[model samples]
Target: MTDAPDRPNGGSSRGLWILIYCLLVPAVVVPLLVPLYDKAGPTLFGFPFYYWFQFALIIGAAILTLSAYVVSTKADARERAARLERRDRR
Candidate 1:
C-alpha cells in the first residue's frame, strides 16, 4: 500500500469520473426544459423560433458552465484538503 492519500482506492479515481457525469446534468437538461416557442410566442427578431431558441441555448450554456465550475472547484478543494492533511502527517 502506498502512503499517497491521493490513491486511496488502488490508484483508481472512478469516483472523479462519476462526479463528472453528475455534473453533466445541466448541460443535458436545461435545453430540454426551455420551451422557446411557447415562451417567446410569435417572433422577437423576425427570426420565428430562432431567436428564443438561441437565447435558451445561451442560458443553458451558462448554467452548464457554472455547474461545471462548481463541480471542478469542489473537487479541487477536496484534493487540496486531502493533500494538506497528508503533508501535516509527514
Candidate 2:
C-alpha cells in the first residue's frame, strides 16, 4: 500500500474544506466590492451608511475568518491523528 494515510470519510473532510473556503471567501470578497456599501444615506448615529457598513464588514470578516480558523484547526488535527494512527499500524 502507499504511504499515504487512509482518511476515514474523506469526502466529508473535503466538504469541510469546502465549507472553510465558503466561510473565508465572503470575508475577502464582500469588502472589495466597494459599490455595495458606497452610500451616504441611512446613517447610524450620524455615521453614513458607507462608513457604518465598512465597520460592520470589518466585524463580519473577523467572525468569518475566526470561524474558518477554528474549522481548519480541527480538520488539521483530525488528519494528523489519522496519519499517526496509520504510521503506528506499520
Candidate 3:
C-alpha cells in the first residue's frame, strides 16, 4: 500500500472526518430544516415556538461549534500548533 503523504500542516488528510461532518450539522441541517419547527406551539415565557426556537437554535449552534472546537483542539493540538508556527514564519 502507498504511504500517506506528509502534509505542510503536519497531519495527512485521510479524507472526510466525522467530527468535521458534525461541525456542519447545526449550520447546514438546522437552517435547511426550518419547516420542521415552523410552528406556534411549545411556547417559552410567552414567546411563540418560531421566535424561541430560533433563539434556541442560535444557542445550540454556538454550543455545538464550541464543543467541536474543544474536541478537535485536543485531538489535533500538535498538528494545529505546527501549522500555526509555519503560518507565522511565512
Q: Give a tens-digit lDDT track for model 2, residues 5-88.
A: 466535235667888999999999998999888989999999999999999999999999999999998788777777677688
Among all windows of 10 consecutive residues in model 2, the one with the lowest summed lDDT is: 4-13
- Cα lDDT of candidate 1 equals 0.65
TM-score of 1: 0.52
Candidate 2: list runs displaced more than 4 Å: 1-6, 9-12
Whichever of 1 and 3 has more lDDT, that candidate is 3
Go through the candidates in order and give each one's C-alpha lDDT: 0.65, 0.84, 0.71
Per-model TM against the reference: 0.52, 0.84, 0.61
All candidates: CA RMSD (Å) = 6.4, 2.9, 5.4
Number of the top-ranking candidate, with TM-score as the measure: 2
**Total colliding residue pairs, candidate 1:** 0
Instruction: Provide the lowest-lDDT 10-residue window in model 3.
Output: 8-17
Give the per-residue lDDT digits (tens) of candidate 3, residues 1-90. 767434655453232246756675766688679798899998989999999888888888888887777766655765676567668888
Off by over 4 Å in 1: 1-47
- Candidate 1 lDDT, tens digit per residue, 1-90? 987446432333346656777767756775666553445456766766756776767887777677777777766666666667678889
Residue pairs with colliding backbones in model 2 are none
